[model samples]
Target: MPELPEVEIVKLNLEQALEPGDEVENIEFLSSKLRTQLCLPKDIRWPLSINKLERRSKYILLHFSGGFLLSHLGMTGSWRVEKKIKAQKHDHVIIRWKKGNFWIYNDPRRFGVFEFGVNTLTNKWLAKLGPEPLDKDFDTAAFLQSLKSSQRSIKVLLMDAKVIVGVGNIYACEALFRAKINPFVKARGLSSKKLELLLSSVKDILQTAIKKGGSTIDSFKNVSGEKGAYQKQHLVYGREGEKCVICSQVIRRKVQVGRSTFWCPRCQK
Candidate 1:
């Protein structure tokens, strides 16, 4: 699945490639089923012009003159810009522009979504999401206040979309490890100083991953079909049983909320 960094990369690429006046020449839905509540093909208004592209959390918000086109690249889904060549088997949605550009949505697992709405903030998925981790509004004081009421593990709290958006499992583990905070530590037990470190680590890890084009662990790829380079720079994630980079202690792996979490036991208290 594409996380915040990956989604932000897509938004940036689309913002550069798609102009304000670019018209939606055509939209083709090859698959009968889309992992969306609303029907995209029928709900989306035709003859729409592109306004801008934005990302909230992991969702891509394509703002058009008429309304918003929301997309969620679920597991194994990607958006690629290609020529007018033959469409592949997994190319479920194709958006052709008037200037001969083709934007193809390929999803092998068919878990991706394409929905239409008038307002993005009023949409079901975007409405309930918490503050974006990279946003300036995510202040340290407010963050500590929010953590005071939660008894969940700090790692789990970071991954909760209702508490903080876009801190996925990989980045959460990496950030926690970088902050020297154990993933299993309770949210309310964290000190203010530790929380500050965790916040900074989260932002740094996320920004660095975005700069490296995000982690291509398994099936993630950018709009240009290029693999990310951040996986090579991972500190603890996917390095279970390996020597810790800082303290030379062996890294460990454990399951939290049914997801695999990696950490350096000695480095991260």
Candidate 2:
């Protein structure tokens, strides 16, 4: 699945190619269903001009003059801007712009979504999401307060969308490793100093990953159909059984909350 950095990259690329006045000339849904959501093809108003593009958590929001287009790229899903070409087998949704450009949504697992509505921010998907980790509002004080009452594992807390959006498994492991904090520590057990370090590490890791176009662990790709390069810079993720770059100890992997977690036993305490 595409996480925050990946979704943000898609938004940036789409914004660069799309203008405020570029209208959606037509929409074609090659698949019968988009994940669990059902969007009637005729419900989409033709010639709908795009107003802006925004990303919250892992969801992409395409602001239109009348309403909004919400997209969630589930596992193995991606959005690409391409010229007229033969559509692939998994090309689920295609939106033709008036400028002759085509925005194609491809998902091999058929888990992506295409939802349309007005006042979308109040919807169930976006209503309860926590503060964007990259936003200025996600300060150390606020983050600490959010974790003050949680006894969950620090790594689990960090992955919670209600605590901080977009800190997926890979980034969570990398951030904890960079902060020299064990993923198994209780969230409330962290000291103020350690919380500060953890928060800073999270921000740094996420910003750096966004700059690198996110980590492509499996099938993640940018809007240009290119793989992300941040995976090569990972500190601990996917490096299990390998030597730790910092402490020379073997990087260990464990399953936490059913997600794989990587860390250096000697370096991360």
Candidate 3:
């Protein structure tokens, strides 16, 4: 699944690949069985140019003159730029550009989103999301207060989208490891200072992940069909039983809330 960093990379790649005056020739849906049938608003003006691209959590928001295209790369989705007009096996949607290129949305699991709508900020999925970890609006004082009131384990709390968006399973593990905080520690049991450290770790890890083109755990790729190399840079998420890079202690992994949580027993205690 594409997490915050992966989604952000896709948004950035799209922003770079697409131009302001590059008009959309057509929006074609090759499949109707995504998480839901992706529907385009009927009132959209024809041949509109892309205005901008934005990412909220894991959703990519493509701005246009008439409206926006909102999509989520649920588990196995990706967008690839190609001049080939023919759709591949999992290519569910295609935005045919006027200049012979195509923005292809492919998903083998068919669990992704490719929908068009008029309003993005008012969309329910985006509207209910909490503050972005990298945004200035993620007030540290308020976050500390929230952490003090929650009984969930620190890693699980960090992964909660309602509490803070974009801290996915891999990132939560990596960030917790970076913060030297045990994954099983209760949110309420953590000190404000420790929580601050965790917050910083999350931001730094995510920004670094984006810089590395996001992790390619499964099917994530940039808009240009390039595979990400960040998975090779993971500290603990997939390094269970391996020597901890910092303290040389053996790394550990456990399933918490159905997701594998990784940390160093000695370094992250």
Q: Please count the clashing residue pairs in each candidate, in the order shown.
A: 0, 0, 0
Model 2 lDDT tens row, 15-82: 88895568889777787787766565466667887878899899899887767888899888888887
| Residue pairs in candidate 1 whose N, alpha carbon or C atoms collide under 3 angstroms | none
In model 2, the clashing pairs are none
Misplaced by over 4 Å in model 3 are none
* Displacement of the residue 129 alpha carbon in candidate 1, Å: 0.4
Off by over 4 Å in 1: 41-44
Candidate 3 similarity to native, TM-score: 0.94
Tens-place lDDT per residue, model 1, 1-269, is 67888888888887777855778877777877768643554555567787778889998888877688888898888888766746788888888888778888889988888877787667788889988889977767877888878888999999999888999999999999889999998989989899999989999999999999999998888888898888898999899989998999999999999999999989887
Q: Give lDDT tens digits, candidate 3, residues 166-190.
A: 9999999998988899999898988
Q: How accurate is candidate 2 locally (lDDT)?
A: 0.86
